[model samples]
Target: MKAVRTVAMLALCVLNADVPLNAADAAAVFPDGAKLELLWSDGEFTEGVASSPQGDIYFSDIAGKTPGRILKFDPKTKTTTVHCADSKKSNGLTFDLQGRLIACCGAAGGIQSVCEVLDSGELKPLVSEFEGKRLNAPNDLDIHPRGWIYFSDPRYGGPEPIEIDHLSVYRFDPRTGDVVRVTRDITKPNGVALSPDASTLYVAETDNGFPEVPGAGSGGGKVHMTLNAFPVDRHGNLGERRILKDFGKETGVDGLTVDSEGRIFAAVRAESRFGIGVYDSTGRELAFLKTPEVPTNCGFGRGDDGSTLYITAGKSLYRIPTESRGWFLTGQTVP
Candidate 1:
């Protein structure tokens, strides 16, 4: 047992290196003097960070599968508190046009899928099944300006039986009340977001699986981790899979968001290069924001004119000033 544990530790250290880049990484995407400041540290695994309509920040604490909960941060107090004791272990989160908290809560229990948490503390089930069968797990999500919620359903580490034939990306249209499979080209999709113009869709192709049982998250170089982009038609359907960024042996990202100028901000999990990477639409590294731990997700703060970027990693939440606003935070409201 001791020998096995030693090997696993060594493997983890070996696999986590910087993502292979070209010879030309000369300029910085972020400001050269940029600094990341710790905002809070109160969870075992913090993730699913998002901003509310009133300017408050919301996130989830997975607590290593004991029981996940939702948390809220008030800018006025600069403090964090438990928003919902039962978050259903939701990972990635976003808000709808109605300012309602839309959560992808199907990952942990395999029971409740995507849900909308009202201000009254009521959890309304949104999408749980497709073609009369239960879902695998809904991981991350993003809301289109047209009221459609696009989410990635991938089994990371859980005891739930895989009900779906293949892990894919899905969009739930509130208007038609139907869930559309956007794309199945990915092995294990993790993060899902959109461009500012809403003309393109972004999905982080982490196609990696982490077993929820013992020895979970141990090194297994079997999964391919990459980021992909798909063109969006007028109807919100995907066009084709275009590989944007491939991490090869390095760990891919968990969540990603865009800025108003179409710049991509990815929460990279590669331990050796753990932090946030800012890239242009063409996949050119513009800047890199270093965090103290492996970042899982990020959000632009409206309080600072969208200049502040919030991050969720390990057991803490961090914030850093940026030059761009969130992709969808123009105040015109999402469509």
Candidate 2:
């Protein structure tokens, strides 16, 4: 694998790092003179960035003709290596409480489910079909503290026929091996994230007017792009959703991560302002860090590098030092 290094000149605009302005909150999320450093830029479509327990960065490269690859970046060695060569088009990845790597691996002609990627690079399928029918495509996911896996299922474009009617979010219980449809209210859900305390579930509704149909040029009707907050119950159920931020006619968020304070760091794809948008849990914009390309996903490192934020955009991976640390349910246990 090849790696590239470039300094990303950032346009920083930070208001409040946290809700209440303390001595620490007074400091901007991006430290003074902070900039994005390009780590690698040789992917087809980079997505699903997650920091391992060892502080190593892992992201997916969704290929066009070949199977997706999960690449790992070591901050100490400063090298990029292939973690999984045949990822089955894995999109979103996270580590469970037991320090196991869980991934949403289902794209066009892909695995079509959320599975656990073992140390031997083998996939252990957790859930493939929701009911009796196969899922459209597992896109992104976040695990709850209680071991429930919440993921998004939406088909953007593919030659295969759509099995499920609605593009929705589903939650799978690994203990019981049961899958439950969390909600199908969104037009097309792209990213799914849980709050630090597991009280709120943030879902990014990025509808880009489905793929090309035989008769119609662009099939799926109206496009609704927005970031929503859904209240999550103790039983892993979702309540009425509240539209947090509406992008109107522009492309919305792709993937997002929450900090320890529950602040959302979203990969906004708005053509007018493409970058990472940091917002409070109540939908208030807190900061914005512009990227060289349209970002797909973002995650924060752990341990000594906990303040560094890793971003995946276009075909490149970028990182910047931030004042905030990522919130992980599993603590800092290494697998």
Candidate 3:
């Protein structure tokens, strides 16, 4: 009976989804006129969207002054449930090769920096402290096909003191639990994604915590938004960085994903032009899919041929149909 009710609820939610996106005419990656359907919206701010092994979706609700929580959605039941009461205010999340949920947690309140969500729903610190100091609030994270976990530690609108001097990106080896600083080149790095072939690394540079530039939007001289790509060295270090696209002062890129074909899907939070922008490997803007609000992050749903995308924007979570499967879904997650 509970399952039945859940299914019914899901049906009703779909039928009444806020900001419905019609994808019947959807074609390729950009899928012009694709519908961006609102799926859930009960949180203060949602992030950390990911598809689980069970083909379910999970997201985070960092309620600022309140205790952070993690929410999971079971597509089979078409229901949403609370997976964790205290989520350490995580921002970006993704599952590892070992099938464990890894998160760049503790964005707002004081908690673990980066942790692994255990089967018991407990939080296990993966790389919380660097050199004896708690890491700056980790904003986003991604795993390499070789099992190395790479994350960005950027302080974006949190009251926590900046423990780490520079806003940088880091890599952690799960097997040895060793961490290496990837780069601090970007003034503010918010999103980190590996290419489908795992040889290229892409980072989204956004000034979420800096003073905005005059023409660079509303803040002081803080936000220099752009998409950058770097070559992955043979020894696992990032090579020279290349500018993919620069948004000047317009909103900056937040979290981003890549499709099986190495195309980049970026969740752009540029207020006036907020939405997801799809670009090819060379950083050419191939297509633009607009979301109703400022999007934070995105992840494709389950199955090897999954074509559904789950997006986290502001206080709501939305979904839209996609024409291609995500990198992981294509069975090419790692080297």
Top model by lDDT, which number? Answer: 2
Candidate 3 on 13-59: residue-level lDDT in tens? 12212333333322466444456666677778898888887788888
lDDT of 3 at 68: 86
lDDT of 1: 0.75
Off by over 4 Å in 2: 1-27, 211-219, 331-335
**Better model by lDDT, 2 or 3?**
2
Sort order, lDDT high to low: 2, 3, 1
- Over 259-318, each residue of candidate 2 has an lDDT whose tens digit, in order, gives 998999999999888888888888877677778889999999999999999999999888
Residue pair clashes in candidate 1: 28-286, 29-286, 29-287, 30-287, 188-207
Worst 10 residues of 1 by lDDT: 1-10
Candidate 1: tens digits of C-alpha lDDT, residues 12-56 = 121113545432342323433455667677688899889987788
Model 2 root mean square deviation, Cα atoms: 4.3
TM-score of each: 0.86, 0.90, 0.86
lDDT of 3: 0.75
Q: Rate the local accuracy (lDDT) of all candidates.
A: 0.75, 0.84, 0.75
Give the distance in Å from residue 202's predicted Cα in candidate 3 to where it truly belongs. Answer: 0.8
Model 1 spans with C-alpha error above 4 angstroms: 1-29, 110-112, 209-221, 303-305, 329-335
